[model samples]
Target chain A: MTASIIEDRGEGSPRNGEADGFPTATPLPVRTSEKGEEENPSSILLGTSAEDHHIARMAALALGLSVLEAAIPSPLPGVKPGLANIVTLIVLARYGWRTAAWVTLLRVLAGSLLMGSFLTPGFFLSLSGALCSLAVLAASQHLPSRWFGPVTHSIFGAFAHIAGQLLLVYFWLIPHTGLAYLVPIFAAAALLFGTVNGLVAAHYLDKNPINHKIQRHREMRPDCL
Target chain B: MLSIAHIKPGDWLTLLLGALLTAFLGVTLWQGGAADKAIIRSGGKIFSVVPLSRNQLISVPGPLGISQIAIHNLQARIASDPSPRQYCVRQGWLKQAGEVAVCLPNQVSVELSGKQKNYDSLNY
Candidate 1:
């Protein structure tokens, strides 16, 4: 259905082929009728749509936040507020899971590179945590949205992130049973930080509710689907 | 669009799970039983084992110097050490299984373990 709409729009708009850059390579019938306005054409030549640009911009923002977090001195090695995840929650809420996944992966990759911890144990731990949290966020989508807001998603993601890191630490790094004693402390930290992150995300979402309508429009875009 | 309203059942479920996990871990740590003996290790090797039931002070030599470990009344503590920061001495006592006091500069570590020991490794 969406393909047909894009096709119809393609036939009507002379600017579609112009935006695509490689107009002569693939010629199609062009109708003279006009209706739809021409969307941003820069993405067509770049092979990346406006939505991709948006994702990249958000990913950069998340990376900046991650670097800022790393700059802060922490007494405990593993304990962090994980504020970078706020961008993930916002992206998930506004753009859905796929965009959120892209932003998160990019943040983890680029953030680690900027911090000079790429391919190190720290990178692996961050990757594992991000992956687990993304999985949780994806799974949380099935729940009724009326009840599960950014706060709930944030909490679940935070706990899963910690649990994933702990599992890796136990099996690969330490392999000692004594690590169990610290579980309580870690869990408590997870709970506290999760709630804090959730509240921040929720507050941001509340103030910027306009993104929901814009995201809905983007979802209807054929290239996005 | 996602609702920004009161907490839902799913939120409660997560909250409940996190609370339950925290509570379980807290209880286990709080109820950590007394250890029968304390194991002293130096340079990653077992230096000595002192029974906590008997009151005694033993000195173990390591890279930095000797660290005196005192065991008495089902508790063990670092009595004295030559390390710059008497961090191990400040650790006070290890009455529960899974507790550990380490004088890292001296390469001496004291850990409590029993039949019902809770931990297999002390990370810090």
Candidate 2:
């Protein structure tokens, strides 16, 4: 259905549309375009590998969630439900930590840019939060799958995320011990949101489990899949 | 929807640990420790450290003028500040360690400290 929409939009000039942004599985034309370009139009495609495209799409989804979350009024400056983390949890469970990290970091960077907070203290706080959560997720992903799942990972990630951001606020921004008073409130938020996000991720993963054949194929030849 | 059956032992463990962590943070970081002394600084320098137990009025010289810090009944407060805005003066009282009141324009600040150093370097 999505492919058909893309094809319909690109019907006017398929190669041009593909060259601009929308990457398709269709083979690139060997011959130069009628526009008299010397190089292959495929060269204009931003991402060559399937993984890059996957990450880009996932990142875009996460960015949308971040924007949506920003619209909701928060009680405290740093206290947010972090709805984008749900997408990160889903990506981590489905694809893997590396892909999830790419999606998450890209979302943070692009989200900051979109919010006009890039390079500001807010951006650093956000970056630190994302980094700490990613680290926790990466480590927790190694735990026994039989015993642990997305919810467990989400809790750890959420705690780490808030902890990192609070530490940054104390040392970098406020530089006062008074900030410690807010830790419990932020931690409570982390716990609540973490459990909620983790449950969502678990339910989604359970409904749409990884295809064993595809997983095997990817393990055999990672680039091809 | 996630049923109770979907939560594994590890998930329960995580939830438990997260609750414990939050409780720990609430207990330790929420209300600061009892302060024993008040450290006053003027012009970016430590002017004096006075015991909170002994009630006294400290007059510290700053850029704007003189700032008066009052310590009474184991509590400290900025009695007066020469700065335009009496922010520090209006900050009522400081009885907990790590509490601080700053008169920016006057370049005077007072911070409460506890016996065991409310927080170490690593806590930052």
Candidate 3:
């Protein structure tokens, strides 16, 4: 994981590397001669790197939550607490939007496969909802972090997700005039669940911040030098 | 640990937005009360159209049994039903143009329709 993060820093623009407080421009030779020479054989054979493993771990966590949620019978067909969204929020806060997007897409794919809903209407709805939430999260980044946190982002994502699914249903699945009246109910549910999930994500982020972990790892690495 | 103690402007913004959305929906629901009639359906077919202006009681045959509906003072409600859940009755009253009360087990539903429809369909 450290190696992959270093590689990311090394490949990023100088300004980005500087922002991360890493001297990427001059570290390539040292990195390759030392740790890069001892690449793990399993990672090489599988064509998976530390970064892929990191994404996989997050996706797996989200998939587990999705499966768990499915086990509980819900009164409404489309309404679920959406606890899996917590992983996406954490990834977005720690790793940035691109990584969060990858994690979210992976979760949707893997989760559908696990639930045996792949290629079904359920899968399409999940895909659309995930994409919509990610788009909303991306847009919400424009808001000042000081004023916004995981909870706010979660609310936005939830509303966007429901809107996306409803639009699809209206246009393709059921074009009947009766479906629009349920929007208020669904919107209320989204607000409630979104706030809950956001608070959970915020708690997790507060306790286990990725930047602090990274900084600690960096500080401890010189002990082995 | 990174601690977040206070609600920020963004948090307030989201809360305000959510409140605004709720208010908008509430207003729409309130405005929907102008509906003139209630359209009742049984087994996916139009069972009856009762004028909201009249005070009357109507019983429609449904899957489970007869679902009784009452219309009075420009509003309609499910008075009684044989359905176990009685969800339709729990919906209370429908005065809005797009309001609906459904008894899924009995396959009975009542929807309001007015001169001007506020929404084409609701998505959930």
What are the candidates' individual DockQ scores? 0.29, 0.36, 0.25
Superposition error at A97 for model 2 (Å): 1.1
Question: Model 3 off-target regions past 4 Å?
Answer: A1-46, A212-225, B1-6, B29-33, B36-113, B116-124
- Candidate 3, residues A71-91, lDDT tens digits: the string is 989888899999889888877
lDDT tens string, model 1, A28-70? Answer: 4443333222553332332333444566778888888888898
Best by lDDT: 2
Arrange candidates by TM-score, descending: 2, 1, 3
Pitting candidate 1 against candidate 2, the one with the higher TM-score is 2
Q: What is the lDDT of residue A35 in candidate 3?
A: 43
Q: What's the distance in Å from true for residue B1, model 2?
A: 3.0
Q: Write the per-residue lDDT of candidate 2 for residues A97-195, one digit (tens) a residue.
A: 767787889999999999999999999999999999998888999899899988899899999999899889878888886677778999999999899
lDDT at position A128, candidate 3: 92
Best by DockQ: 2
- The predicted structure with the larger lDDT, 2 or 3, is 2
Looking at model 1, the pairs that clash are A177-B120, A178-B120, A178-B121
- Chain A TM per prediction: 0.76, 0.79, 0.76
Would you estimate the TM-scores of all the predictions? 0.63, 0.66, 0.63
